[model samples]
Target chain A: MAITVIPRGDVPLGQEHEFFKFVCPPTFGGGPVDAQPATIKFARKLDVMADLPLPAGVKTYNGGNSLRLWLIADPNDSSSNGATFPAKTIRTKKGDVVWVDTGFSFNTHTIHWHGIEPTPMNDGVGHTSFEVSGNFTYQFATNTAGTYIYHCHKNTVLHFIMGLYGLFVVDPPQGPKFAAANAPGAFGFDPVNFSVPIDVEAAWVPGEFDSIWNDLGHNAFMQKCDQNDPAGAGTFTQNGFLNRFRPDIVHITGVVSVPGNPITDPRVSVAAKTNQNILVRLVHAGYTVQEYTLGLDATVIGEDGHPLGVPPFDKYSFPFVIPANTPFRLTSARRYDLLLNSPNAGVFPFQVKFMDWINGTVYQTAQTTVTVV
Target chain B: MKRRDFVKVGLAGMSAVVVGSMEIPPLFRCVARAANLAFDMSFTEALVEMIDKTQVYHWLFSADAGFATTGPSLPGPTIIATYGDKITINFTNNLPQPHGFRIVGTSIGTGVIPNVNKAPANKFTLTFTAPPPGTYLYIDPFYEPVNRILGLHGAFISLPKGGNTPYGGKTTPNVQQLFNDLGSTPQFPGDPWLPPPANRSLIWLFHQVDPWFNARAQAGIFINPDTLKAKFLPRYFLISGKTGAFASDVPNISIVGNIGEPHLIRILNAGLANHSPHLHANHFYVLSKNLVVQNNVLNIDTFTVGPLDTVDWLVPMIRPPDIPGLKSTPLRQLIPHELTTVLYTLQSPLMYPMHCHMEMSQTAAGGNYPQGLITHMIFTGDVDKVPFPV
Candidate 1:
């Protein structure tokens, strides 16, 4: 099976233009936009290629497809930028209702707001509801301010690996500057001036790509979706390679992290001034369990979009700080918001060890530095 | 019907319904006034039937006095102790190989017991003071994941000293009152079926079984612990050693509660692979992870539980989030009224699934979808009043 880009003519008339405009409206200025039940349009891109040029070899595959939402609106800009591996991050504010308009396109796909709890109809689990064969608007309100994710829930195992997901962050009403302030005891940061309490936010979504699975066609395992063969009784001639997952390439937040080289992707390898609070939103977007070891002491304040130690929740639990060098683990779909403040200036490496699920053996280790100037 | 009768009806004709037997009594007894408690446990082997009727060999921890009887189960037995109580387990290894017991998240008896080969030596006594008030995993530390995964793991719950509340001072809403407020009377009035407010808890011990590993162990094939040569492809996923339709029927796996009440679900990922347990009907408040109380409690429908990680969730048994109500958000309006208000009435007793979000865990025997790591959270009310199917 080879990668085939859907011709522009094949798309529904005026969809690419209208939806693209809705995604990146003329009013979008890189800041948080009011979701006042906003209609955020997204069109599926199939057979999108991601080429990683590593020192050892140049690994390439169209295993990735972005939910061309608000981040990338230009239909002509189809280049596989490292930043666009997983669809660009969708940022919104609390109390905002986001109507994700997944426009009609190729094979059936549903965008599931991973951690957010919306109505079942909008939840995007095709088995529970109906798969979006045509245009469907998933509606959900951002009730909580925390880090989240959105991905295609159709044939999730394959669709997720195909890179049809991205970070979905809901900021507090005070916006991005106050994102870290949501944590208990988070003070001394000035969100207005963005100076004394400079917040260096970095989203690290570490994922692994199995080149074999990536090379397969988009409908490689469509037979499994046969409704008639609910019990999997029907004999499908193709080998069930979906069960066998062996990842060869590892990437950190879309940028491929070569074994011996420093990940210089500005989005991942972040820069911060001394005394600046570095808030790292770590989302484990891979199949394997990930163990993250940070060079600086991190006060973990949130998990799965809930700020730790915040009111109502604080009645039952409180946030605890993890000492530097201590490793913490996260499974797929787990998000942890860590607030790190460095008093001294130095280059600190944040390492992620992707291990086999059965045994805690590091299959791959990807590193991104937190350069505190 | 009485609670016991309800249990009998719910578990009728199910061969795997081991509740009300020796395996379940200890889990519900949260208030242990005794200063010290002693249990006679044996490490034995058994053939447990899966949902697909596949009889799988397992090494389990049985709460039997001796290994003379074949009473061992897939998940051993739940050991519950009040905070500050001394727990003494007279553990006997009935299996051919040496097995050891150690509690994760507790301070006492942290070391693995030495190999018990001879008669007197095989029967080892382990005494440990119940650490803090939280949930813990008691497993055979021998060979690490190999021994633990083979069914030698169980839940060790340390109840709060003063009361049923997990944190001692906190209090949950009255379940019976909540049900009454929702216009339903208790099916078994004055019956001691429901735990006291804030004391209702369920243990979900998530585990996956690899048949090849079990077969190898049964054949006496030595598996190197440091370097596992066999690829781990678990075919069966279990919640407290139960799966598929059988899991939801088990009183221990499926959560049954009244409207507006809270049920604390103590979830332990005993499997090697990570699991994301997704709950329907209502989102749960993540109270703590790995015995540490979470400062930022998140109300989420799905949360991740990594290998060997223990998470405590407080399930607020309210109306389903998608249900149309006066407080429905703007997004809720998008859902058709038939699917919301018209379909499910407030008096309806609804049942929703609590399944693993990890796509592969939804399968058993490799490709049997919806046959693994699935259970239910049922709200108790007047079921006949419900006009539509839930």
Candidate 2:
């Protein structure tokens, strides 16, 4: 079957205008190394394109700093810029063919659907035979029911940093039945057509940025520079751009400016009925390592793009519940979908800490507020 | 209206003005475009003058027909090319010793046959197709240590083909911007993110000179190559053949371009040691690494370049109208910004420093720093006049 495709655009967000102001405090963890309140910094900010409205009957989300989880414009729209960072999210049911129009005019790239085992021809990679150019479409089928990731495989080092990836979730066939069977404890009555027994769902993607690296990588001057030339290599040797790994900021959902300050409100909150089970999908879309700890008990129901079940695929996959206060680790491009068992009548925050994989220094911290009322 | 207010309103109003059949203003129409389509270099031995008012013997290359090596622009010539174009160079070696030329991107085999007893062949020739545009280097590989130190190195660049031509062997439309990943529209010529194209580019050829080596070579002393490497101590640092605290201070070394234009900067490290070229007040996009055009590059200020490394970059000659802290000083606040659109325009020309981040190379013979391998990029606006258009 021909897969349905949609188009979206990703516009850069920077300090291009004078109206916007940067409100983050400058420091490693938004705190001073010497322990003093850093003076608030300000600059005219760049315009961040608004996310697309949710499609009819589809879930809506902002992955990073107003980045939409779906197509921003119609595919037939001729006036669009034709470039989208974190290409439009793909939401479908298991056993369905999904075609994504991943073509971009800005650069050469391939979309590697992280978890799907598509045929070599359908898998998007530059070295492989599946690379697409101009306005070609990427077609594949969802054989597994789970949450997965898709990112550019071309120039993996630089293209991925430019935000060329998105989340792809394939729901089970009996989603409503599963939700109805596992009704919220707060509501004594079983609900009809409930989706996976969840009262609320949220997505958290951890990301980092080094403006200098991003800017330099996107520069046109070096586009043609001879990389093999011994005397022409451009290397950064400063604390800010050190060894090409000094990240300016560790951000959540893309709300923070790089090489600047951290914000006071770096949290996302989701409201839940008292005793409701909340499903939180965590995806690590950056190069750094992340550790997410929960203050309330939550069970790991799925990993990568497959739900834990059955003999071949279900071994040690499901029913693995982590007690509150324990941390789970996630490497780059990894995903974990957790079903949280909300505690008593109070707000429980899910704490996440990001750190460098090489060293053990905390780069950033974020909390997702789970308000159980 | 205040002076600043009038200036802003006047410029904004001029955008809408149509002189009968004219769409753009006369001032903008006068803007010039620069392109370096060809190059000619000759390798010869001559007495080299230092920036610190000193003189030494040196073997160098220059575009000058006389093969003049003792001047402000001493390090040979930069070959600026665009994508899809074929470039040919006829090199005449005036030095007593035999030398050959090898460029990175071009398919020139190493021909390091040294001239023994003044051979009949005193010239070399090279022609090649340039593409996958990027910064490259031309060097004398035969006598790597001796000849290179004597300043026989320069930069080569393959610019993006102009007027709608695809680059890097891709079927996509011609790159409107410098890099394929930058944006849809071309950034330099005319764009909201930058001012009008001033039509200029820049190249910084970095090198180091050991006064002792030059003095010995000048006096016809047969210096051992191994000994030279073991006792290597550089005194004078150079950028584009001139040693100065700032690029503007050195004649023919200062890089000047029109404000608001995206200028291409090719920085080549021709020394034995590594040096980090840092741009103050602005950051540039590194367009390539080695000789390959990168799909996605980085924007950096200080880039550590080792010996023989070439870094190609695109620097937009624009800055914030007024820095948040420097608004009080009239000298610092010159650019104009629209209150409603929040867009910035390069109103008055400005000068920014480009120097080595190594800190020590900025000095002459280990004296005060900021004298060697340092220069300035002049963004010519109404406030400053440009001596060299490109």
Best by TM-score: 1
* Residue-wise C-alpha lDDT for candidate 1, range B1-390, written one tens digit per residue: 233233333322212234332233222322233677877787877666655555667777777642223345556667666778887778777777888888886655434444445766677787888888777887887787788888888788777766434755433343222222222323222222223232456788888887778887878787776543347778778887766544653465677654444567889987777788878656677767888765545656677788789998877665454222234232223233423332112212244567876656766665444457888766553222222223
Query: What shift in Å separates residue A1 of candidate 1 from its native position after superposition?
Result: 54
lDDT of 1 by residue, A83-127 (tens): 366776778777676766554345556667776765545566554
TM-score of 2: 0.42
TM-score for chain A in each prediction: 0.78, 0.65
Superposed on all Cα atoms, model 1 deviates from the true structure by an RMSD in Å of 11.2
Residues A44-137 of candidate 2 have per-residue lDDT tens digits of 1011233433222222122223322211222433434332334445566765655554444443445666667532233443322323444444
Alpha-carbon local distance difference test for all models: 0.61, 0.47
RMSD score of candidate 2 (Å): 22.7
What is chain B's TM-score across the candidates, in the order shown? 0.78, 0.69
- Candidate 2: segments with Cα more than 4 A from true spot: A1-373, B1-41, B62-73, B82-88, B113-116, B130-132, B163-198, B223-226, B249-259, B325-349, B378-390
Worst 10 residues of 1 chain B by lDDT: B340-349
Write down the worst ten-residue block by lDDT for model 2 chain B: B24-33
Candidate that scores best on lDDT: 1
| Fraction of real interface contacts that model 1 preserves | 0.16
